[model samples]
Target chain A: MGQYKITLSGEAQTAIVRHGEQAFPFECCGFLYGHENDGRFVTEAMPVANNKKGDRRKQFEISPPDYMKAEKYALGNGLQLLGAYHSHPNHPAIASAHDLALAMPYFSYVIVSVKNGKAADIKSWRLKETIEKKFAEEKVAVKHMAMFSD
Target chain B: MAKIIIPTPLRKFTANTATFETSGSNIKEAIQELTGAYNGLTRHLLDNDFNIRSFIKIYLGEDDINSLQKEDTTIANDSVISIVPIIAGGC
Candidate 1:
């Protein structure tokens, strides 16, 4: 129903893929930051620890405080909270029903598919607020700019 | 019918099902139907007053109930309601 395009630095892309590979069996989750107004153009990927007590391989959870901290940090700097990122271990990079259930409308959810402890496919999705609830894929525009902020 | 989603942590109480179908008109009614239909959910979802606990956050579609009317947020038919618990504390 609707679509979003995000610009991530090459360094930011490497951070999330590396985070996914290093976590391997466990899932890694993080938030993306960038300036906003026209569209979300993520320039940074900040990986945080997955604190979910559930199966890490299947589920990744971010505490509310972590969100607050990320928001504070992003605002303190000169950026906005663009979206979130997570790795799906041994699963395809597709938005699950669970992801859709928890997705916020304006945020890009980047899901990296890790198979056999290696990053395979990467995809971004957003929950579209159309007449019908739809999970739509977003185009990720990787920029070659120098890293904005680690 | 609106869809009420249960997070993974609470799935053990919902027979391992992640989603349930309900015909609740509002968020409060939907959650009430959820806890009432499922066993072991009443305590986790509500307090002794049967009010939704603070830690549990409900989202109607993409809007959080807190930004809406809390428990009184309206739910449309075929809406996806996510009952996400606010995971906080601990390292």
Candidate 2:
């Protein structure tokens, strides 16, 4: 197991929570960005609705057209995608079995789990095979199963 | 017996079951078995050469298959595999 940290601004957190609530019965997803060397992630894009399943777990996906837009934006600004964020409504704010399988090595996965029908918990994860890793939440640190990148 | 957890997006391919258990020695064999049973999903999860699709992500426990052993990653009876597709959108 490895550790990862996901650092994002307060405004980002508020937007993520609000988007999660808006997509109550399905999952919502979006992107987080910050300076390459900086620690704070700023929520940039708007949240998208999951057209796949109507489940409460928001699954964020960029469409082809949107991907082109995001790519242009990143190229123009020299900012790469830092990571992704989603919500697990009515479930624990941990990586689901589906999450671990599809994880990218360099990106962070942020999950906000709603409790009692409310967004009550937030967590982050980074997948590592056997190597030790560190994730930044508010600051950088290394420990057991800690998450990095937001 | 390794169990595969299907993501919500792919549930339509699996008849809406969240998890499936099969006997296989490694991740590749397990996924092959799954796609065989699921029909058209093979194209969605893998390319003609069996590499994972760019839009999809696969993980075993806390370790991503790309960082671990790819399709050759061993699957034990107790292991759980997760499949999550990348989502893109803004609020």
Candidate 3:
């Protein structure tokens, strides 16, 4: 865990895991919207279509329009587009080289490992601002909220 | 002047400025003015051929520039330009 951390709301976490399981064997990607105070506070996890052209099994792509829509949604909701989350089917929740290449600075990348259609370890990483870009592990904090009956 | 909304990731190059106002009339000229103001943003937003990078998507309002005239798309004084980077990755 590094100094960078992301706190995901309970609903956000559940959405991410459920998405990973639903998209089993293939990659699922989405946007994370929240505020950046001290650290990232993820309040929502909005799933978007995986627009990758070929070999959807090991790869995922989010179209520009979808990205714009997500950003607009965040703005409309009084939040910022903090980062993104994706699932790695049958793989570890680690940032890959391909991830490093596509990653941009100042955004958190959350990776979920789905093993056999079940969501397993979940981790987050941030791209280091250096000539040789690399991912630094980020501490994930899941905020659990108690449910109340009306 | 067109308003260019710089994404969070690229804000560092602009001295942490979130939005920039440029007097350029078209998308290309607006970007040129932006880069001229912040020299560090040149490589990140444009390629060697001075074209917008494939991974970077520039939008004139809600429409993607690719769907329009691309960099040559004329921008209104009140037009909003957004720079969105493609988010993709694999295992």
Candidate 4:
């Protein structure tokens, strides 16, 4: 299997962290839109409401309708739906058992740790193709764009 | 024939093909034709009882099948169907 990695644009990173902070005490979820070249390049982060019912502090759900919409949006913008990102309120930025159970191959799972209503650590993971169904951490590269005045 | 759009995550099971054509009359039959062509998709899309998995969602155009008659939802020749997996998880 090839090594997997994802690069997030500065704006995309800010959008993800902000969404996590805004949804403090609960999990926030969204989709990552980008294209695959040498590796995945995330240019946009589109936040979607967590549709999971009942207790949502430790879980988040992205309805199929929402995913459909995200796909359409990405296609319209000439990009691909690379994967999804979600926040872990008051928890570490790690994939839990629940995450591994629902994970699919080829999609990067980004987890953000939110501490006291603030965004902390962030990591990305991908499911291994083995029968054991395990996740391996993917290298994350954040591009900080410089504001230039011309 | 109706067109079934396979999401990226599930494309490996479909030989990396993004869309499939089926002549089934309804959603159930369409899926039957799909899984028939791609045996690897059977376990991922359906359970032991041959029911659509809870995490798998089928949409006809922009509307979810659950909003319609579900498996019985009929499809037109030009209809476009989408198979989207539920995105859910936490820490």
What are the TM values for chain B, all candidates?
0.92, 0.89, 0.98, 0.98
Query: Which candidate should be chosen as best, given DockQ against the real structure?
Result: 4
lDDT of 3 by residue, B1-35 (tens): 78999987798899989899988989999999999
Two-way DockQ contest, 3 vs 4, winner = 4
Please give, for residues B1-91, the per-residue lDDT of candidate 1 as tens digits. Answer: 9998765446657986868999989988888888889957787678789888766777777677788888888888879888766532210
Give the Å error, residue A8, model 1.
Answer: 1.0
Q: List runs of model 4 lying over 4 Å from the truth.
A: A145-150
User: CA lDDT of each candidate?
Assistant: 0.76, 0.62, 0.89, 0.90
What lDDT does candidate 2 reach at residue B58?
73
CAPRI class assigned to model 1: incorrect
- Model 3 chain A: weakest 10-residue lDDT segment is A141-150
Any runs in candidate 3 off by more than 4 Å, and if so which?
A145-150
Residue A123's lDDT within candidate 4 is 91
Residue A143 local lDDT, model 2: 28
Pull out the clashing pairs in model 4.
Answer: none
Worst 10 residues of 2 chain A by lDDT: A139-148
- Interface RMSD in Å per candidate, to 1 decimal? 10.3, 10.7, 1.1, 1.1
TM-score of each: 0.61, 0.52, 0.90, 0.91
